[model samples]
Target: MFSCYYCNFCKNRKTTGPFTQIPNPKSVLILPKKKKKNRAAHQYHLHLSSVAAGRQPSPLRRPLSPASSVIGAHHRCVPVKLLLPPSPAFTTVVAFSAPAFSRRGPTSFQISALKPEEEAASVAKAQKLRALQTQFFSFHHNKIYTKEAVELSAKLLEINPESYTPWNYRKLAVEHYLSQPDCNPDSIKSVLDDELRVVENALRQNFKSYGAWHHRKWVISKGHSSIDNELRLLDKFQKADSRNFHAWNYRRFVAESMKRSEQDELKYTEDMIYKNFSNYSAWHNRSVLLSALFEKKAEGFLSKEKVLPEEYEFIHQAIFTDPDDQSGWFYHLWLLDQTVTTDSPLLASSWPAHGYDVLLVEERCYNVTVECGFNKNEDLLWKPLSASNSQTARVWVAHLKIPSSDLHSTVEVSVGHSKGIISTRGFEYSHPSMFSFKVHVQPMERDFSQVSVAESISLREENFMIYGTQSEESIINSFNQLSIKNGHESTASNWRSEALAKEIECFRELKIGKLTLARLLMACDVMSYPFANKLVHSEEVLELYSDLMKLDPTHYQYYKDEHSMVLLQKVTSSKESLLQHCFQYKDSVSSAICGPICLRLNNLSLSRMGAFEKLLWVQMLDLSDNELQSIEGLEAMQLISCLSLRNNKLRSLTALEPLRKLKLLRVLDISYNEIGDHSIDTTRYLCSSPLSHSVGSESNKDETVTSDVALIDNWEAFYIFKDFNLNQLDIVGNTIADEKFKSVLVKIVPKLKQLDGKLLG
Candidate 1:
């Protein structure tokens, strides 16, 4: 038997006997006395044996009486069988007072029995929140501009700061408050300050909150906060997280608003970089500020001559400290690009090498109007020799109506502001009645007389020394002796070229930044020197790209593209290649066709087509059997008519979008490609299945079922070929080359006379 204190309603005050076990017990009812607080009343019952009812009761061993109003007092244990009511809503807290489980005080356990009242309270709370949202939205929708509405918005926004609508409503409310007749600057400031406080609280919860940040900007724009305070706040935010781009952008906005000098901002960025070199945002900001300073030539800032070297040194230190960091490397490349200057597009050469009726300008030009002495008009219409109807082309052709009077005179041709004179005396009149003449405009001759023999020898010797070639020294000396005999002048050495050579050597010795070294070599060779000079480091650049492909296999394709670009540049830059292969090629009849220039570049394994500006003259190109996956650069071949992309890795027809401008394209060979089979027949069959029964039943009726067929005709291939008037197309050996595709191809290209090498009857 457990000994414990009984309830106050017990009959005996003192202990009498040991607790006795009853065989069967009757139920004893107990009720809680009403409290002055008017709490919910509850009735409890206890069961006791019939034998215990007749026994003398002990204080510690007595069963709870039926009229017991109170449970055991504090620190008491009552051993009684609890019987709950049948009502589902009955709820109570059952507390157990017992001896200490350890050295602690008496262990009390509570069973939290939930009540109807607590559940009701929870439901009321949710209802209140919903009502608050409804009221806030009602005010927003109705455009309510009252003090109460603003307070209500604040209440909602405090719970969810990211809610943009509430922030907007607050802005509207502030505007309404300012528009009041009695609204003074002090009052306006007070309202805005409170709004700023709300935004600040939201920022404290989530520093990157976009709505809070935007609201802060709006508040500052309204002349509520001082620039110093805003900057200090931004400083705090940036100090917490240096890479916060939003904070940086806002800081720039603040600086712009105040018209602060970029020089000060430059110092600030330097400080940020010093604190953390890995901060790309700081580096980017520094680049912008420095570029602006150079452009403006701002006083007290580093001059253009001094700034580049200093920045280079700064970035060099950064990269050397951390080789794997990309920030410093990117900035360094930018600085290098800035140092290199690109030459403007000039008239490279012209075709018809003598006097001719048809004139071809061998450089990309737009809005070409030519003024010639042969033509009566001041400007004759010259069209781009482009089959794609492009605005620009390397070869611009014009058929001049040359008058008989000007045939013997020197014909002056003017393209834009630049003018060139062609002697009509050299023209041979093949057709005297038609007035056909051939005029060739050759490039101006370079003056080699000014070149110094001694400087040439010294430069060659320096180059040879860098290469460490003893055999080439004798050859160079012989060349120098020839130059001396030919009577050339003396000049100073090219210090810039020597400096680049030294830098290249230094980078080679360091053996780091292979990509950087490769780019530097390219800039030194291609950009640093004039077009007439030979590229000294082209071979080394190509070798570096090859090494990079192996070293960084993840960017292998990128390196391969770069290698292709360099190779194409070398080929295009050659005088012989440009004149002989590109321009002077003739048809089988040994006569120059006035049509598009044809270039046979097949089997070159070219993944990318570089030097687009140089090859814009080409109209008929054979690019078959290579690693070409996409025809992106082919659009630049605006004059192309016949294009063969057979046995390539073209996977999608969408890659043909670049060729959409090639309106003159007729003969196309896309055979053996990987284009997917998005057959129109399949789509038609799927869409027509539901209408088949209807057609069969309504065979006698006049209802047409061509809607599904019409829908199926809008495939991608149809769209790509809709504007095309192709006469010959070969799509054989591809997955898309089914019989249905062949039938659709005939419909898509209505002018087609041949498909897949077979005549489309």
Candidate 2:
């Protein structure tokens, strides 16, 4: 058995061992590079011969099979491992083969001459070539950077130094060979000198080769360049072609690498700027290059000449030239915002070393004061009006005369990044995007009246900052503190008081109906209680209620006998003594709520109550089509669950949370409300609990059991409504990816469902 090698080639495909054969062996060909190693080579051939016969492939000595003996031709077997048929590469090797041996080979497709004199002449030529190669290796490899190799390299350099192959080889000779075992540093310097000489020759040979310039880059990358030499060397290329971007690029790279970038980078940037202002790649690279120069020349360059970090003239020139390439303006805005921006000092401090005002202009229309966006949350800020202007939309900044040692002594403004925008005219201004101020305040949107009502939500001034819904932790403490100072809650309660007094008065007049105001006041009860426990204590409100009670017989009767109304029931049916009537009731209104002959508080304002008491209070009331703003009323309706607030101007799903706990109230029709995109997230919260959910959950369905089977299909899709068999799911949003994300989510919460409108069995 023989193991295969080289893609379907059997390695020892001849014989098992030397001097041994399988069924019967004949001849074998032995190839030995040196005549002294013929015996070992013979054994190798023998082993291969046996392996070819499929004999036991002995690891010690696998033999070759005789092709003639196996196929009955007695033809000599050849051992050349010609994986592919003869090609140009194989023919090249025939130049070195021995004539006698070469002529006897089977693959003799090239030559067959047997001339003795010619063979003698070939032998002489071979000897001379061998001597030359031996001399070359001895001097180059023996003395460890021997003077001879250096000398020869110098001569070679003079001839054709620009040839990359030799230059690379020269690099290897110096860097690799000189760094070996006992190689001397001084000798290595000589080799480097030789390398430089060779490079010079190559450049002088053909300065047009980009490879030569690139090679010089590699040399400089290793710190092998001198300012004088680099300048002098680069001049050669510049003299050849002035507009050569490659030469300029190389010059820029070298200037950056060296510590001597006084104004060279900016000089290059300015050059590129003036040559072609609209070249974005050159400008972008210039930004990177300038950072280094700015770091180097922070003192005189800025102080004496007032040289800015990013010059507007150079960058603006690009825009001025084309005024169309957005990238040019982008860089310009980047420059202005970047200069003078220091990190934010703790509280009160001057700005950093930068000295330019950057402005972010939105579509070139709205301008915001922003530094160059160099921070994470730059896009989210609006520029401060203090720093912005419409023309060129740059921040106004005067370079501060600050020192390095005293930099930390004074606090400074933080250099924040802004969203940059470019105009069709190629004028770039940064829009004060996300991170425009000390505190993030989202711009208010327009009002319903289409006014510029996008409120100026200065975080320092707003009432309450809503962090997140349900996640009270997200509400920043600052917002909470500000709320107290702003007096928002006090203002809200006052409105509730007014609405309450007005409703009671309307009942007395029997003119404005129940919608006058009493219902709204009752809904504002934070305790979720129906009415004031001791109404006699509170006066103006009580007077209004009394006046309404006296207006009509029906109104008087309902008020007199009412105690079980869901909104203000508190009806204590004790057999003590007291029989007081608040509203008029013509019949057993307590039982029928409102038996036609009796009246009902149908249009009650049940919003604003944030807590629920959990009881059947009222039903079949047309509370629908009212301006009940919030869902806060749903928390208190423990018993009075049948709600119909359809065809009204309600905008919140907030009241639904408390409603989820009510085990009673069933049919809810909140349709025709202006619940937009935000309503989706809000709705999911209200209907999440057991009673609030549309689905009838069973005891057996826990989180673990459903994680595997249904979740694979359920993850991308969420089941919102499941009444019996009618299931509606939403699966077409976000990146649900494969079922894996879904599988994991089901494990987190197995009861989540988002439904489309449907009536399930």
Candidate 3:
């Protein structure tokens, strides 16, 4: 059995017990005895079991005191400092609401009852509180009782702290007091401090009190309280209950207001995370801090040498400790999503030593400076003419001079943002003005993070001195080896052997390093490098993916997608083999390594399509006049810009829904298919399905109008591709109502320039 207690602020006592289990005082009373002085006739015991079952309780009578009535749920109760301790994570708290409780006592909530002696006192207190509330409301509406209103609000708030109305009234009162000429600095500070303390007291009662926290922010904004003290209080609040979203938000506000160092906040987040790895608040806090801390780092903060390793390790440890925790996984994804500077080449290919103009190619349209440095006796730097900043404009012109006798010298150009250096041996030049050089630029399309990291790792002499100061090629090779290894290696091998060795090392590390979320992440990382860098497939990749599928069943599809890509990459070297697997797997090849080879051969009769995942770059596809019946495999082709499916066995237009994700699609050819007959009833059949109905509304239209007018007006509503701005459509041989179909199709795709090779007038 649980006991009940009453707070001095609120005269209500709360204790929850099952209605049938707890003894009913009403049943025990034989007749009316002397009424208890502290206990009011309105007080009654409240059963919690009924509330838990979603039943509304009967209306409660007016208590002797306003403090006897709790305004909000205990879960929402903003606890007072002198009352019970804070609740944890906003969950149900069970405590005996007795008077013998300390500041750090276990949290308890109950519907309170009053005693005989307190009944008289409660009535007087209720009367005083009523007078104060009435006075505050009068000043709020009339704006005459300023000083009295503020004092009344304070008194009313002490009884019912959660009431936003009284808090707002107090704010108006404080603002008026500050506006007066008598308001000195010390007086203002004293008032602000007092306000902050009141808010703190309210927060202790209800940690999630929105009004209290908001008032605290206003008080802090007035430059009255120490942010350090606020932070300390927030720290304690978070420690008491880490998932207090309000406290976390307040901490961020105070930290930002004080311009607190991100490093300190990051450390605090780390401490909280160490205490509870599942705390998403701490992880989210870390993400915001990282973004703020590295906002100005040109190459991005993660691309820095010192930062990536430590960050990877930290996230690794977090996930390793709790593999099921979503917080660390999300943070890891955020780390990977940071924009790595795009590494574009200054020149695509080596240039001949002549006085010809060189062409520079930049990957993206970002404005950047390009400098050409000639190294002979001394280094000379020169800037090329300004190039138009557009990603579509692939070529930039730069003048170059090469001497015939100075073939041993080198001419180097620095790409902006430390992308890399592109240089060529001095070309043979006859006349400085007559001869011109042509430099072809090949832009690297990969993210700059890996490139920058690889470059940084390769430049460390102490790490690779054993190989002797090597050429650029050897340094790169060594860097790849080191990166793939889980730990230090005695000797490095060629690409294939190194990849295999790394896989084995990852396996060993997984076994030795305790099976953790980090192990799975590390395994995925080490296993992916082989295919990402060297196109070497290992059993370890598929195995780890399988393990991840089991560990994170929620993301099983993701592992499947990655597994398919790895398998596709292994056979990419052989064009014939790649096409065979592409047909078998139905996935597009990575554009970085190979363009998606066309597999459309009418002679090769295919009946089915396979769903493939890694096709972010696929733009055009031709699959016309094949024995295809379903569009089941088209879901993963999100980048398809032009799709050809003319003269196939497609009987319904319903198959076109999967193409909605292909926002870039501009041309579609589905001509000469047995879609429907040349009857007006065909529109009814197409529009009847739920998927078709999603295309347009039938709400306002009559049955006949829905078949004609609604069908024409909202024709694009038939499928997901209604949004595609199709410039051309080929439905020539279909036996549908050609005129009506064309009209509706045109309305669906307004930019339709051609229909079945005929211009849409």
Top-TM-score candidate index: 1
What tens-digit string does per-residue lDDT give for candidate 1 at 389-458?
Answer: 3544433445445455444434554433433311121111121111122443332232111212222101
Q: When superposed on Cα atoms, how far off is each prediction in RMSD?
A: 30.6, 34.7, 21.4
Kindly provide the TM-score of model 3 when superposed on the true structure, using C-alpha atoms: 0.43
**Residue by residue across 1-761, what tens digits does model 2's lDDT show?**
00000000011221111112211110100112232322221211111111111122222112212111111112233434222212211111111111112111222332255489989988886686556445655665654345566556555545443334445545555676645788665655555555555566767765544445676677656544344577677777665644344565677676656655545556655675566655544555566655555555555543312444225545435544553343454464344323312211101111121222222111222222233332332333432111111232112222233343432232222222333333323334321222121222222232111111222111111222222222222112211221111111221233234433443453345322221223233333321221222222123333434554453322232222111122233221111100121112122133212211111222343322211121112222234444443443343233332344554444334333334433333334455555332323323333333333333332124433354565444422233222111111222222322346434433443332322122112
Give me the overall lDDT of model 1: 0.52
How well does each candidate superpose onto the true structure, as a TM-score? 0.60, 0.28, 0.43
The models' CA-based lDDT, in order, is: 0.52, 0.34, 0.45
Ordered by TM-score, highest first, the candidates read 1, 3, 2
Model 2 residue 361 lDDT score: 15
Q: Model 1 reaches what TM-score against the true structure?
A: 0.60
What is the lDDT for 531 in model 1? 31
Cα lDDT tens digits, model 3, 1-761, are 00001001111111111110111111111222333334223322332210121111211111111011122233233333222222221111222221112112223444465687788898998898788777777778987545555666766776767678877866877788889998898988888887887887777776767678888888888776677888779878887889665687788898889888788888888888888887766777787777666654534454444564466668768766755444565565444333121122222222231222222322212222344555341333322111111122222233344445555444443333243223121111111111122333333343211212112111111221121222223323322321212131211224323433443454355542212222233333333332243433334555665665574443333344444434443333233333442221122223443222233323233333431322222345556666554454353344455566776666556545556544456667787776664222222222323434332332223323255674745443444335566666677887763787777777667776777766666
